[model samples]
Target: MKKLIRLFVFFLMFFIPASRVCAFSDGDSVIKIIYKRSYNNPPFPESTNNQYIIIDGNKSYCLFGEGVRGKDGKIGARVDLMKDFGNHTLYFMGPMIPEYTVNDYWSDSLPAMHWTIVNQFTTIKNNYCQKAVTNFRGREYTAFFALNIPIQDGPWKFCGLPGLIVKLGDSKGIYNFEMTSFEKVPNEYNLGIGKENGDYSLYKPLFKKWHLRRLEKDKARREADPNCLDCGEGVTVRYTFIENLLD
Candidate 1:
């Protein structure tokens, strides 16, 4: 038994697949929202991308995207989504420190988005989606929110609104988000991590304090590791928003 255990440990250290940090586990109660975003330009927003946002009242929310990976095969400037309700902060990980840029949709005064509910109603998922518009960078962007859900969250970091955003699109068609489906996920905890290390404790208090250290180790490992040939050329990375308004 001792020999077998040693062999298993050796195999995991060298032969196991690269590590990925899915901090939160999926729950059966997920409000899945689909979105289609485009830059309407070439080699920039690159191409039209289909993304999904998964939210659970019991767990943290996550946005799935075809993000750019670094040479180490770890996500760089363009990160897969991570939202921590315990800390109430959003972190956008990239290759280097992210240099926030501005486009037609975002501006210097982006932290304070003035949203006005127009009271226009539309049917979505057999529920009413109320229309609301916010002017940013001198452009009027419209979003449809379902107030019945009573959840103040949306795709990416576009939360704090009165309700769940069902559809978000700019007048010029620069970017668009729309809901597609909803389902439930198990509220189970997942501990499998770090080359066969045992289960992790993700309780709110313990996790919040330990997460920063774990993140530092992750960053160091990614930086020290060599490039992954399998990663290939990455998609062009760009962002208009990186930080939260309250932070």
Candidate 2:
């Protein structure tokens, strides 16, 4: 009997495909919102990306719709944002090196928004939403919030409104976020992560400026390497980010 149990354990450990292994930690979310972001960076056509925000009370986790792993079985160059509104901290993982390293985690204070409520209303997903505007991190944003939900949260650290932000966009038309789906997930639905760890130990918190500098260094390295797969020959690179903070 012991021998058979040992064989079963061995098979379970070694025979299962790595992809089948779940990377999400044991945390559950009550509400999940999917946002479609459309944006354009100069030299490249406007592209659309999808992100998921799972909210459980005063905390939420955000990640790309698809998994963060690359074809080469390495962590891709992506940023995952997690907000702990209870603590007033916004945690972000990355500036990861595609097919390379998973960088350290850095955090900054949750963005403070001074919102001006407008006397405008529209219906979205069966909920009546009101218009509000605010300037966040250098971009003027217009948001529509649904008072019915009563959750003080929204996609990508856009919170503190009277309710959930159903739609958000910047003034330049460079970035727009529209919620595609909102579902009340089961309690068992894992929030994916309680802390930042990418196949490695939980990363210690670092300064945001340090992380930004590392990102710049990584960008320079790729530009210098002519054979870089991410940036091919004659491709004019334009560096643009969602957050344009004045130094």
Candidate 3:
């Protein structure tokens, strides 16, 4: 009977900690995401940018903004760091706009739109990492990763899953992103957005209108400056409308 009691105590000691670790690791650990510019084409004539997200349990951070041309001939997006926690979403951050605008960038534009992942799934590609494919706006995007950290979050308007997104790219390959480094976020990390609602659907129309309007403006600019080498003769604009995502 004493031996059985000792065995019971041993079992409790081993199983209790293991269970606790499994619970804590199950898609609910604080994660840090660091982003770095990877590649861009067309030099200054095109827009190229990357975005990333860091999820630390219920708290989250997003890094993105605009792309810049560095002195080393590398073009990449500007980094905008956003931190949020406790019942917050990505839309709470705010609009992401280019640092440089020609003129009247938002004159006839609608409010920027936001999106969030409604569903997602992941497959382990190898022993090191897994490939996560997410469905957002009726389209699928592929994200690759080398970490097994379980947390569901990504840069911009993307979330909903059981693991952290370390890298993501659009279906057509227009945008690509990855996390370069990470660390435990300090307690001072502020994760609040002042006077902003966290609804992604509210911003969809605004983004569409802005994209179309920007294309028009680019077309007019190119017409005015025929000799401009960066204009590419004209702008070739292509974007999937927010409305189409519903259908």
Candidate 4:
């Protein structure tokens, strides 16, 4: 009976199509994503440097955003994509560097999304495709995909679909993202949740009182300031909308 079961399993494994193998397990992998930003009101559309997102299983994701406008370091956010538990962005000053602290609670997620196919002939990486749409963060985006690669993962917090998200952007024609190429994992990559024996399972606490107050003050100041640089007085403000890969 044992021998029969083993033989049946072996036969099934050999019969599955090669394309089905693109459905990756929940293991670790390093992916490279090229990002670009644009502004409709100001009419400045340009491509910027690429970034990296390392999926460290269920605990963490390391996002390395680079380019003239991007932060130069990697931010180790949770798999949920919220709460700055590590030293990333302006939240951590020089004195706070090298120290790790978890935020009060995590509130972000790349939730399971519902996608309706728009078309199936949109070319991506020269492959036959299916274009679909989904909404996130108060915005709706049309994404082009190909079912040949069955993995639900893609750049940024984009996930949980029938195929790899090759490209996506808002419907009003604001921001856009697309896959450039694929490569071997970098040497600096790590598969562990914390990359080492450090922050995983144990994180220092961030004082909510001080942190929340600071965040509120910062928001108020930003709202008061008119961020438009050279625009005329008639224009209230010029907004630079960023398609946060971390979102």
Pick by lDDT: which candidate is best?
Answer: 2
Best by TM-score: 2
Ranking by TM-score: 2, 4, 3, 1
What is each predicted model's overall lDDT from 0 to 1? 0.47, 0.65, 0.46, 0.45
Q: lDDT tens digits, residues 84-164, model 1?
A: 444554443221212221110111111235788896877677545678887754456788877555455566545556666
How would you order the candidates by lDDT, starting with the best?
2, 1, 3, 4
lDDT per residue for candidate 4 within 147-223, as digits (tens), equals 55544555555666666567777787666666675432332333222222223112223323344455576557666
Name the runs in model 1 displaced over 4 angstroms. Answer: 1-29, 42-47, 65-79, 85-87, 97-112, 137-139, 187-247
Model 2 is weakest, by summed lDDT over 10 consecutive residues, at 17-26
Cα misplacement distance, residue 52 of candidate 1 (Å):
2.2
C-alpha TM-score for every candidate: 0.48, 0.65, 0.49, 0.51
Backbone clash count, each prediction separately: 11, 1, 14, 0
Better of 1 and 4 by lDDT: 1
Tens digit of lDDT per residue, candidate 3, span 4-115?
9967854554454344224433353434555543433333344544444445455554544423456665433322333333434333333435622221111111112233
Misplaced by over 4 Å in model 4 are 1-47, 55-62, 66-105, 191-247
Q: Is candidate 3 or candidate 4 better by TM-score?
A: 4
